[model samples]
Target chain A: MLKKRIIPCLDIKNGRTVKGVNFIDIRDAGDPIELAKKYMQEGADELVFLDITATIEKRKTLAELVEKIAKEINIPFTVGGGINSIEDVSLIIKAGADKVSINSSAVKRPELISEIASQFGSQCVVVAIDTKFENNDWFVYVNGGKVPTLLKTIDWAIKAETLGAGEILLTSMNNDGTKNGFALDITRKICQAVNIPVIASGGAGKKEHFKDVFTQTIASGALAASIFHFGEIPIPELKNYLKTQNIPVR
Target chain B: MIAIIKYNAGNTKSVENAIRRIGFNSIVTDDISTIVAAKKVIFPGVGEASSAMSYLKKYQLDEVIRSLKQPVLGICLGQQLMCKHSEEGNTDCLGIFNTKVRLFPPKEIVPQMGWNNLQGMKGDLFKGICDEDNVYFVHSYYAELSEETSAACDYILPFSAAMQKNNFYATQFHPEKSASVGEKILKNFLEL
Candidate 1:
């Protein structure tokens, strides 16, 4: 049986980790490499680095930072944000990322999904959809949840799979930073909509939220940021809880 | 030096990075002589079967890879191509393991993506790795269970998660992306 993955997402800006992580025993919360090493030690199944940095020089620094972290961490790593072209994907992957997540750029040019998928396998391409329930319908939002498109969330997910997206990182904009729980209703719907694995992101407050998503929906993974960052929920302990609950976690 | 055989497939960079992370140096190469002379050759790939094999045949890499005596580890598509045949492209493979790769039944989810546990693990390749330890896998087709199977996994059906027949070793999962358990497996392979 395939295990459900627990992922810790690190927000990076100016080539350093922002939103000071409050984990215990971690001396430096700002160093991305240090934070990454700590998360790997804590049994994080995978790591996602959202580069919130600005400028071309900062992007180069981000690559350098990724290379440094890649040397230290051995698990699967994913990088997203500002990745618009094949060169950007190649640079990040060469610097040691296993997969690259695309959002705004992919929505603007849907073929970008297949374009990257052709060069790399679909397994290496992750289409991140930021969605919000609006007007009684789930709408896909781009530009970091600022712009809403007429495309429905479920429709976009099915389209992405057809365009060769291996995985869907479905983040509910309304649930983001809420620390409530994952958007189970929409997540379950998308999981049923596509055959590819769905990674439910945003609104992970407690360990039970992870459980709710995994048991209630067919999501293969759950991604969280502040909960892990603030040491509110240690992954090893969370995995132990999931194990007891009969949820196979890695 | 370790040589990761380069063809049209992707993920060689990740493999190379993993090797480097393990404190070893490796070069991604397609040259027959380079691969033949390397201490350990990794035939890692991720792409459609027919085209990848065609590229290998075009460069005469097929003959060179077959004749090499050094230990060769194939990952994912590399493992599929080492089998006697693949259902993906109806393409005959390198025939190193005598196993036939078949597509998952249509009723099941086609690609068994994400982490899966390995059972019946044996031999040096899996040294220091625990049975039922989860390893990463992403593929639509799998090599059927056979005498060469070193590790077995059951998803849609029981299949060879890892196989070894003499110096030709292969894994249907990506050890490079499988975390510390995977790192240990790679380290053991290098030490072998």
Candidate 2:
């Protein structure tokens, strides 16, 4: 059985890790490389670095950051945020990222997903959808859930897979940073609709929430940020809890 | 020099990076002699088996790989094609290992991805890793567990995680993508 993956998302801005991370146990934690190493040591199953800054110059810096971080640490990492073209996909894959996740760019140019998939393989491309519930409908949002789009969550997900996306990373804006629990209804719905793997993001407050998403919602994986950064929940402890619950976690 | 055999697979660049990180110089090559004279060989690939196998046969790499004396490691699709046959392409493999690869039953889900534990690792590839250690896998078809299986992981059933019969060692999962556990596995193979 496949183990339920526990991922800690790092929000990178201008090529720096968001919070302080004790890397070598000798320095301050604001460095992305240090934080990434610490998380790997702490038993994070995988790491996701979402680069929120979008610009031609920032793209080069993001790739440089990915190359630096990947050299020191040996883990599968996915880098997203402002990724917009086939060249960006090529550069990131060459920069040591295992997967290149596209949000706004993928939505605007659906062919980019197919294009990247054709060149990089579907497994190397991850389609991240940021959604917010408005008037009881899940509308896709871009720019880190700041702008609204006409795409529906489930509808867009099906299209992403058809466009050669290997997996779907769905983040619920209503639940992000709230820690209420997962948006079970939405997560489950997407899981049922797509044949590809769906990683539930947004609200994950505790270990039990991890259990709920894996068991009740049948999500392939659960992702979180605030809890992990604040020490509210440790990655290994949460994985152990899920293992006992018969979640096939490693 | 280490040569990572390239069939135009997606993850070949990462293979080159892993070797570089471990202080090795490697080149991505499909040429026969370049691979034959290399100190160690890495066969890294990710894509449809049918298409990949076609490339190998077309380039005559299928023959060169079988004749190598040094240790060779295959990741994901590279491993599946090392077997006798694969249901993936209605394709036959190089026959380095005795078993045949097949797609997961239709009733069971296809493309079982993410982290999965490898238990009972018996070869040098798993020297430092334990039975409970997990490795990342991303594939829809797997080589059914056989006598050559060195380690096994259960998705719908117990399947091969790592397999070894002789100088040829193969794993269905990507050690390059598996993090610390993956790094250790790669180190073990290098030391082997």
Question: What are the lDDT figures for the candidates, one per model?
Answer: 0.90, 0.84
For model 1 chain B, give the 10-residue run with minimal summed lDDT.
B105-114
lDDT digits (tens) for residues B31-110 of candidate 1:
88889999999999888898899999999998998998999999999999999999988998999989999988874555
Q: Candidate 2 - CAPRI tier?
A: medium
lDDT of 2 at A102: 91
Tell me the lDDT of model 2 at A219. Answer: 77
Model 2 per-residue lDDT tens digits across residues A8-89: 9998889876864433453656677877787888888778998877668888898889889878767788988888889888
The number of the candidate with the highest TM-score is 1
**Model 1 lDDT, residue A239, Cα:** 96
Best by lDDT: 1
